[model samples]
Target chain A: MDGSLAERVDYQALVLPYARSPDQDAPRPVRHPVVIVGAGPVGLAAAIDLAQQGIRVVLLDEDDRLSTGSRAICFAKRTLEIFDRLGCGGRMVGQGITWNRGKVFFREEPVYSFDLLPEAGHRRPAFINLQQYYVEGFLLERARALPLIDLRWKNRVTGLQPQGDGVLLEIETPEGGYRLQADWLVAADGTRSPVRRAMGLESKGQTFRDRFLIADVRMDAPFPAERWFWFDPPFHPNHSVLLHQQPDGVWRIDFQLGWDADPVAERQPERVIPRVRALLGPKVRFDLEWVSVYTFSCLRMERFRHGRVLFAGDSAHGVSPFGARGANGGVQDAENLAWKLALVVQGQAPASLLDSYDAERVQAADENILNSTRSTDFITPKNEASRAFRDAALGLARDCAFARRLVNSGRLSLPSTYRDSPLNTLDAEAFDGPMQPGAPAADAPVRAGGEEGWFLAQIEHGGFTLLCFGEAAPEDLPGIGGSPLRPLLVVPAGAAPGKAAGLPVIEDAGGLLALRYDARPGTTYLLRPDQHVAARWRRFDPALVHAALARATGQG
Target chain B: MLNTELNIAAPDDFYEALVALHRDLTPEQSSLVNARLILLLANHVGDATVLRQAMAKAREGIGPAGQDATLRTTA
Candidate 1:
């Protein structure tokens, strides 16, 4: 029951407590505020978030152990920020291998090197490569620390009966079968989800014919922590290979196996060793940690929410791992759903608020699917003309910068903004800079009362924040009263000291916040609890702010 | 600068896909498929100069002269 058990425990061998209660000998129906199936990263994140909001959650998983192999390793900046908000950022960031630079190779020659993080003054890195098992381990540890989260391993939901108001679940455990009821059910049960199948729903998309052999090798080689991708390398003639450095001196090598490859033979250690040696050369000594032959697809359900039952993560949608969209997008889904579900459960927001989750995440899933499909298409062109176009782009990349821009080994995962989301209040005034309404709030360096930190961290505690820029917060703002929205004023560093801003004032040390938010003297932004910009204005208008809040919360 | 590089992302997959497209088709049918695909793609490109450069580049890779009838027609 100790909280520190997770920190010192070797997660691979960490034995989780049994799912059932010691005293319960007979099958008795139990009820929980929220029941989340699948204890993977997405479900665990949602459980943690809901528990933090004082919502009791029952998280169930069919398996008792962490995910096998280094699956879904790349954690994007947005994902890290969400993890930070959920109280596990430091551990993940400290253990993760941070890399922003990627080198795209045309055959054996390096054509372009791109920096994902072009600027500084942020808390998290552009991306980190940690094994997926570690991610689930950290989430489980955090979940165990929360008293409100009742985690049950080896508890599989075999039956689902939606009763219009709530869901009746029949769970199969190691001991015996039991019945339970939940106000809401989140099916995060992954690609071949039993929850989705039980409801007779299917994911529809294109399944790629090209298969890939993923070999995780443990080697203490001197390769830098950068993404190295090859297109028709000389050693693996005619096929492409990708290499990435993960934590604990392990490296991920992905080799494209043509459609004709025998899956069984290709997976054999004898066959895989030679191909890996071809990439690493003759003298590099390494041991294979894991090897898997996988075929990917870009698939998603028609809707993410079905009545009180919601689907998150791979259950709702799936994409190829080239862009790291699989787990990263799923985590984003958890973040987007957690707050909305919390509000709906607490009776603070109407049931319509949960509808926004369906709207927003479906759009986000579509964006991920579109990018994934494009990258897959470019990676495995369907015709000679497409190949010709791809080759032309790569060949020109050597000499021309413009052509280099066209070369996409993998676009990599970046946060998708809901620009046209129904919840976003469109800008009534013109503005500049990258951060916009419906986009995740960009982080900036700031100093508050002589303490230096980031802006996003200061306001990410629990609820919505009203950021007033370049001015002192006035007493008793119209929309601030009787709402979860708290007003925080950010003044330019050049502003006069010792001036009371009615509300809490944080100084933007170098005017970075103002510049990044494109603020003049009176620019104000309403940010959601998930750190997404809901609405903004050049000047404060109580009526507009109220309407935007209403729309963002699904009251519109 | 026009893109003249042959750095396709997955050349093996592309080759396999191309082969699959012409799997059961006769030589004449395959030729017609190629012709139709070329015309459709040319229309998509919608640039005469780029198309001409691509044609010239294609011809350059096929050897000096009298190699393919398509090259002679384009010339």
Candidate 2:
């Protein structure tokens, strides 16, 4: 179905066509509510998420087309959930390969294997393998569909200045340069961000003295959609290799070339084809779709927010590709910042609320960087002691179950909880479950309207929600500024209570909601617009809910 | 809770079995076997407090190294 969709179209122009903006011909600089730089995945996600909340945004991209190669291929479950809220999750999942299992091998034997999604009753898979271009192409289409997202291709941000409480940007186009003012600026530009360079800010961290050669090969080999990683296999002695299946029968194979290997020599088809041939033997046939040699560093800015300019994605932080944390974490940054930018732009929340974006996402960046660094260290094993321990673990893993826990083969990305963010209302009573305050809300099967639905869809419209269990929720919540806070009443599939005062009442399909949340009768949870738990109580109380709302919006 | 007493059911047999675990192995292989044994026993214990106590006892007389535990002394 997808193969015929883009068979003969001018793919670049069809995805994002360059057009002149009105400001280029105007005499005066115009102001927009929000302006997002870089039309990459993070920037497009931010634009779509913010525009969905009724904020007008101007999205600028320096380039005229999607990213060239299959750079980022693994999209985690959290990112898919965020994309689901944007109404395009199905398109991405339909065009991507989903996987939840992985295998790790040592020498000639399989040491350990894992299943990422062992439990049932979840809406999305643990992850999906899709090329970076397909992801950007689909996101560009989604951004174009939203009326409020003014996506300007070929508009490059050249100069930046901070005004009283806004940003003045100089954009360069084919015609000429034009000036624009924005109340808020989102820098989703990637590594080597022009915005960061323009502002003269320093990003500090350590860089690995090694290079990885990624070969995206097109083949019809019958490999399952599972991640396979090898440590010192017989084919690639004393080095590592990773294999994954992307859509269109493309296989992503990464080879670890030591620091001393000449990148120029290794990238040649003569060298790459021989290495690939050694692994697949003589029977399999393949063609190299794309190949690149790259190294990575773990770095982050001291602060993601600089006055009116907020940085997201690789602009704010970066890590090695071992954990697949780079793009996944960046997409999460968009989801974290979008709703706060919306609320602040709407005058419904204090600007101080934006500081929590730094607090939460910086913590998340630190966690990702730590994991990425540790996984790289395990994969490379820099010193004698480290190598000994790594080999010992691998040797023992073949016989003992305990050693399997010690192996580290790219700790995949998971949503980070804002455990210490100021926006959370600390639990006053004891609780025991995964839906703790500040954790991303979990998804469960539900019967909404009439058909079976998902719990996350109830708050998909970007509103603060009150999820009350086993009872009818209050009639309406007093919102701070715009729409009223929505209420969702959840009951067992067969035992729903009275209708929630004309509000939508969803039924828990198999009691997974109750089990996952550890809920009792009259339990009410305050979920933020970004679908993160802000507060919870054993029983519903209007006064307490009001306080939590204020605190969550940064009044407290 | 760490039983300092001699708790092996068969003392001579346990000593011989311990020797057999590393029999005919090189120094590096013997050390790896000992390290794996430590990890397995530590996981079997599972009490972090007990592990810490045991570590302190094991390192009682060893002086501090010239570098941090995470850093290389050669550097």
Candidate 3:
């Protein structure tokens, strides 16, 4: 049977049940410490973080369900670690495909392939392919279970006013309209953010001329779970195609259509089926799950923070989808902002601490935009000269190892280091390995209390943690006025696992943690709640660590 | 030696368009465009040896008129 005639593609709508909010019937205006708009993955992740810190958050969403399509299927290792911190890592990892290798092809011939994770000591895989809906569902469940989070659905913000101390929001519910005042407003309302529009801010950048057709199909194909990309593939002449395997046997296929291609005509099943049939044989039994024609633009706001309102996720920036930076970057934005916002709301840090969010994330967004733009240009060359260069690079890639490094289908999202961030205390002592000040805390497996666990799980618990390596315990570090510090003692190999200075001891039995953090015998690391290295020293220095903690919390 | 080659089926049209692309530019702008074009073309022909050969071949027709090898014509 021809694939086109296969019973009209069964479209299953994923809808969450909506319930009337008690706030809808309230007669007076309510005030919340935090009011986050948009219940997407970003907003929900923020809500979970804030709630876990015992802050009451009012989370609002206009829609009552997870995203319809399997958008943002690839979850990077860093993002998985974040989800682990949010308490949903087990479910997501259990339900997704773990893939670390990707193959690149040029016109039906394999050109090059790369392995992402060659090391063996990490807790998570390089990436997992789970649909965006599953991620949101897991996050929503986690957010709902927290008593501090008030998740409201069918609630839309109609107006906003940035006041002196906070922001005012006029929200519309199905039954009636209501007013809410919040000390801080989080706009995770996605790409077409109403909050951003209400604030009269414009995102600026270049919009690519080319468009891509994404199709999610379900079939029991023999394709392995890995990323397969092609440049000018024989099935689709002069165009690029990418295929990936998601959970439940669903496969995502993307085709790059030139700038002049008609989006409407290209989306029709009659047109899409032949394209899929060309790649997968006509006799392959497959059901088309969803189809979309999208043109991506790499745009970001001039600033992520404005007065008392902060933008995150797609609301703060958008990038071309080639690199999976869209949702991955957004989740990172939530992680970065969640800790800083919680500190500000709790009065533990000066509000200026929030400015780091803008500085760090805007820098991150720029990095994402630049990389995605380069990938887009390489995949779809604009002029004859660029096309020639692209073709030459791809052509020479067949025989030359140097040319293989030049090919850029998509770089794949890797967490960018905030080495230059203002909050990072630069290396006063020479260090090696990836774990440096302002770097995301690297995860390593170790023995803790007779059980093996990750290093990151001990540091990111809504407060600063002092990782005391070796037995030399620095005493009486001056407090940063308000924030309490949790001390964790990491003992290297050949060191006995005994509780020293009343801090729990972890045995780095294999010396993996020591290597990952470049830990000397008496090295100390002061990590922020978000698990980013704020400062480190060769040995424990009470006064320097105190000042670094103050600066990390925006007290300086 | 060096493949100073444009694979377009219509070389004349490409040449006309290339020249027209700089028609309205000032002399400095035209020079800038030419420099950028050279860099782009050189980058495409990534092999340094090939680029050197192509540059030597291109310089052959640029000396004094009577001495130019490729352009010297019998009148």
Candidate 4:
């Protein structure tokens, strides 16, 4: 499946046949602004994101094929939103099995249930159970479509020399090795990141001893598209089981095999079948698509950014699969670094802005690790008292609503708000709502240019966006010096169009946009290029906006 | 905030009912039931201040602060 037609990559590579690259023929090293290694979800996201920002991104992967198994099947809403920013969210939501409700059972009885997304007005579902291959295939397809992205298959990073200004990488391709120079390097490599190994960096943290067996079964089961978790079931006593429906009539079943259970023995059909049969009853016929066993660790690097090289995804921070934070957190890591790297490369902002990526993603990593670790502990209690408390909570949860809060099947995943990020301009004018400085901008429906669209879609076009919500549109707002700011005027649902003389007027349809942002008559919000709130005010003020823009861009 | 003062109207009757609830149960089962009871009562008394005060009271007779939270329920 390896070929040397480096100039063009067929869309059918979605079938995942490796192809050779023209980099093997380059007489001298070709320098790209951004070179992203490992074309998994994180790398592809980082590549596509940078390419979307008009940065020439060289995406390299050892294999051209998608991930072999149905790994990292659950993608959270925050991830789908990030994909939307990369122009592929609609397809993801459409292709994946969307679910928001998850029920946890104690023995044979359901003890706890949670709605991930109770409120409406958001664009995507709480989560979608799409196979990792489908996600990577879609991202790969999107990355290939971008002319700025130079995607090289069978390109493995063997050695790296990180210098003061840039990094020189030694790449191994099917046609042997080639040297390439990158102004900035992004390592989205998996947990066993070769780049991190080459740099002598270790992602250190605690490892949970328990192993989980994942069996992707192709079946026409009459199961609703919701997450079902069973703890200490009658069939599989003293263990946990999780069930999720995926696309293509495939169902993901996870059986918590104890710490001492041999992964080799547990993955076999003889051992896994009886467990599934016990849970689903004998009448249900299903074909095993894939079987794998995994043990997880919640780990992260001391810092994500190392001079000219930046690490994103599993390479930067690795979390357990309990909360499905592994892939979601990694995709977010890419999103966090993309804009800062783009700015730094284009000389729009100082290189110091990249440090903010380390600060923020490290915070996010710590958050994910903490949640995943807690969930692991709850699921597999180490001590007698902990197990006693866990069972006590589950026991009480059968009748008591408060006991449900003590139940921790998995926290799922939520986007981390950069509440303490140095980039945020803390609100000078007090406002009510969750859209605080550094909070990820919440999505709501709006009407713009006679077409109904998402509020996030308006700010996602990139760069600093100043959104002014009010009845009286201040004809035009003054631009912050040096930095370009796209100002949007958001009026109430029934407000007259063309209110802001020369600016785009977004009608907050159904009042959801206003309600979600807690908009007052003259409220305004300044959103960063990554669609995170930079600052907000009761009214528009040029001086305040200028100061926020400077701060968000790292000038302040 | 916690009505650490006798709050139950028929305190002795409630105590008898509680004792009856643990009847014919193993020590582990009784402990679990007690834990559940604590959770339910604390939740019913939903005020954070009250719960914290109650928790402080519960922990008072256990041990010193440093070693108090550590469970000795080893295998």
Per-model TM-score on C-alpha atoms = 0.87, 0.91, 0.86, 0.91
- The digit string of per-residue lDDT tens for model 1 on A171-258 reads 8888987888899999999999999999999887777768899999999788899999888889887778889999889999999997
Top TM-score prediction, candidate number: 2
The DockQ of predicted model 2 stands at 0.18
Q: Check candidate 3 and list the clashing pairs.
A: none
Candidate number achieving the greatest lDDT relative to the actual structure: 2
Stretches of candidate 3 exceeding 4 Å from the true structure: A1-14, A472-483, A497-499, B1-75
Please, what are the lDDT tens digits per residue for candidate 2 over residues A359-439? 999999999999998998888776655677788888889899988988998999999999998999999888898789999
Q: How far is A355's C-alpha from truth in model 4 (Å)?
A: 0.9
lDDT of each: 0.84, 0.87, 0.83, 0.85
Off by over 4 Å in 1: A1-8, A22-28, A478-483, A494-502, B1-75
Docking level of model 3: incorrect
- Per-candidate Cα RMSD to the true structure, in Å, reads 8.9, 3.7, 10.1, 4.8
Tens-digit lDDT track of model 4 for A262-381: 989888999989988988898999989889998877778899999998999988887778899999999998898999888888898999999999999899999998998788888988
Model 3, A205-321: lDDT tens per residue?
A: 767778799999999899988899999999999999999999888999999988788999999999999999999987798989889999877788899999899999999898888
